[model samples]
Target chain A: MKMISENVWEIPREGKMRVPARIFASDILMEKIKADKSLLQVKNVAALPGIQKFSLAMPDAHQGYGFSIGGVAAFDMDEGIISPGGVGYDINCSVRLLRTDMMEDDISSKRKQLLEELSKEVPAGVGRSSKMRLSREELDEVLSTGAKWAVKKGYGTVKDLKHIEEGGSMQGRPDKVSDLAKKRGMPQIGTLGAGNHFLEMQKVDKIFMPEVAERFGITKPGQVMVMIHCGSRGLGHQVASDYIRAMENKFGISHLPDRELINAPISSELGQDYYHAMSAAANFGFANKQMITHWVRQCFDKVFGSNENMDTVYEVCHNIAKMEQHMIDGEKKKLCVHRKGATRSFGPGKEEVPEDYRDLGQPVIIPGSMGTASYLLVGTKKAEEISFGSTAHGAGRVASRSEALRTVRGEQVKKELKQKGIEVWGHSSKGLAEEAPQFYKDVDEVVRVSDALGIGKMVARVVPLAVLKG
Target chain B: MKFKFFDHTADIKFQAYGSSKEEAFKNAALALTEFIIEEDIKAVQEKTIEVEGMDEKQLLYSWLEQFLILLDTEGFLLSTIEELKIDGNKLKAKVKGDSAENYKLTGDAKAITYHDMEITHDDGWMVQVVIDI
Candidate 1:
């Protein structure tokens, strides 16, 4: 590894690598990254045909199937390739924060009851059906219109769309989505699928940058907020499977470094089909969170006697591919940017960001582990120049699920959190154990690196008060 | 035991062994079933599934992926594999299981992945897969 700057390291372009691989991390984080296969995955991504600048990894980088979880790469629209591995299986797996008028102390006594109500209102766990079972036609509309469709169905208000990425809906062609994908997705809408998907009640713990926090509406400490982390559920998974099979059948690149890196030319019909289908799935993800937002409001109303006037802070997807024009070699070029386990961090004044936040920069929510503090960060202009405007998504895991389970039991974890005045409700003990806070790197360090590298700057921090995990 | 778990940083990893390739695939399916539901379920219901692939590698991939789709769409929790047959691209199997209501599901497996997937014949036959949860 060659040091490019203080917190950036480079894997020099080598055999079959079209470009160098870059990672934004401190020396300490780099040590951990070097110990995993993530660095190799970065090199593999650089090897992909027509990758621009470099295959970049965010501070929270970790080994994933083909692309590292915190991976980001841009491809030339006319000559590059689009691999399903770059987008991940859970299409548009994202985070949304809902700010409430109430404070933490006001809801402290009712935390347990609120958790119970949320658990009942939001369907979770394995093979759980959603409260809203849409017809085939309704599901297609959801695939096309995304959160806008959910809002039309009385799930949320139109004002919420303005704060969401892509204005709550991308350019999705519902016809591109297969019938089987619809079958799996139709019943899972509004449902929080299992494994790390969670709905947590949090309190404003600390304000790192008071000005940015104020601009983003984190006015005071102890202000209550809700963060939802989920995705398109089974529908996204099926779409990935369907496309990977199609790409493999059409382009038999068996000699490639990883079979999972199978891709189609971005200009090909197959690639266009995948782009449309994936956009539809991403819309499903957007609408999925919006529908759940409706139920979350209902849960609050059921617990607090009146609607708490929860407003959308911002919603952003970590897993996605978008067509954007960026400067390359001092010339503007259209590129397909793939960000898996990485968030889009369009800086201040970018037209893609919401108008209200145009001067303040986009709000990038990074959820920590259940027992840790999460951060709200703002994108930076420097990120757009160097990293294609991307940043870390979460505290990447250091310990495996089995290893975490071996060290502690879920009931014990729950007990410890309760002793600390945090209420946790999970469907299974094993699931809770697997998601133990100790399993992940400290989010504080990850954000610091992002700030140091000018990718993202910290705004506010929030700690979990009550957690509902699937 | 026909199957055992391994450590993968982000996903669930496991390997199953059997006397033949078909048996290995069966044991692999059982491993997925056990991962989803912790407790053993009775073989009260039966379903016959058929799939076709271009080769053995795809056959194994399609086999596991098909079962996952069934679990999501039909809620068919597996109790046991009654029979298995494979000839080139085609595969036929009969599996017995109960409805999802009869078992307590412990985990949610999103998909069967090709990441580091392998099938080999060392002593008998062995298959390894990483499931994204």
Candidate 2:
């Protein structure tokens, strides 16, 4: 690995690698990243055929299935491949930030009551079924229509769709998804599944770019906001498993470096089928988050006496692969961009960005660990030039669940949060201990690296007031 | 006591040990069940599942996938294996457990992966896999 810049390191193409690997990290973060096999995974990704430029790892990259948790790579349209590992098993696992009218002074006393209501309204944790059961046909519609299905069913408003990625729906084909995937997904939708997923109420603490923050509906310090972090539940996982088996059957894994990276050519019939199936799973995620948002609104009304005005600021799909047009060899061409544990940081004037905030750039919501401060950032053009318009997703995990369990106790974590004036409601104490803040790298440090690299600009910073974990 | 969990950065990695191949596969399933609910469940209902794969890795993958499907489709959490037989790339298993409503699930095992998977039966049966949690 060679230092390309103050914060950029490069691993030259060697052996079977088709392209070089680039990682964006500061010196302090580099030390932690080198402690794992994520760097090796980055090199493995570069070996994929038709890879564009360089296989990139974000500042928060960590070891995951086949790709690093914060890995990003764009593939050519005709020669590239699409793998379940690249798209992520939890298809379209994403984050949504909502702005509320309530201020710190207004909710300081009633925070506990509000959280209690939210816990009842939103079913969370493992194996918790949704209150509303979907018939086979209805679930299929959700697979195709995404959050729009929720809005049509009176779960949310039409206006909320504007703030979500892909307008809350993609070109999905439910027929492409297997029966097992649908069966597994039917009961899991409209739930916030466990492990690093959370819903937090936060108050804006600082506004670095006053203009951009104002454009994003973030008005003044101490303004309260809601952040929902979750994904498509069992449906996404099953689609990945079923297709991985299919791909392995058709194309053996002997030629590949890693069996988990089993793939199909981009133009193959099975590849397109997997794409549609993956899109359907992505839609399930959008609808799931949409329903949770509706329940959150109702819970606010139940707790506050008067309904609060909560508006969707923006939503970004963290783990997904999309067909996007970008400059390649001085010509605009469409390519498949896979962002696994990364966010799309499209700069100002991109047509893909929502019209409301297009001039100010897309709003990127990066959630930190529990009881830690989250950040709101704006996309940048420099990111498009160097890193394929991507940024880190979160403070990536640095320790295993067993390691965290051995070092920390759930009760001690809760007590520490209470001392910090933050309250938490969790479904399992063991889950809580595993997700302790110390188990993850520092989010503040991550945001600083992104800012320094000019991939994402910090607009505002917010600290949690209350946390709800599954 | 038949299985041990190792430190993996972003997922759960475990190795199950047994005196025979059948025992090792059963122990692997037990590790998955314990991840969700550590408490031993009472056998109130049973399921007979048949799994087919192209190879031993797929055999293991198919076996784990059956239990996951049961958890989501039937809400049946596996407790104990009443009988299991593995022949070539196919396996038949009869397992018993109660409904998910009977217990509190602690973790979500997203999927089984082929990354760093290992299976050996020369000296003694040992199977290693990573669960995408």
lDDT of 1 by residue, B35-80 (tens): 8887988899999989887567677888998778887778788888
What TM-scores do the predictions have? 0.99, 0.99
lDDT of 2 by residue, A1-470 (tens): 99999899999999889999999999999998899988999999999988999999999998877888899999998999988899888999999999988888888899899888988889889888888888999999999999999999998798899999999999889999999999999988899989889999999999999988988989899998999999999999999999999999999878988888888988999989999999999999999999999988888888776555698999999999999888888988898999999999999889989999989888998999998999999998888888889999999888899999899888888888889989898888888899989888999999999999999999999999998999
**Taking the tens digit of each residue's C-alpha lDDT, what string does model 1 give over A1-470?**
88989999988989999999999999889888887899989999999988999999999999898999999999999899998999999999999999988899889999999999998999988888888778989988999999999999898899899989998898888888888888889779999888988999999998888988876778899999899999999999999988988988888867579877888889999999999999999999999999899999999999997665688999999999999888899998999999999999989989999998999789999999888899999998988998999999999888889898789999999999898888999998999999988889889999989988889998888999999989
Quality class of the docking in candidate 1, CAPRI style: medium
Stretches of candidate 2 off by over 4 Å are: none
Consecutive 10-residue window with the lowest summed lDDT within model 1 chain B: B52-61
Clash pairs, model 2 backbone:
none
Per-prediction backbone clash count: 0, 0
Once fitted onto the true fold, the runs of candidate 1 whose alpha carbons sit more than 4 angstroms away are none
Error of 2 at A365 (Å): 1.0
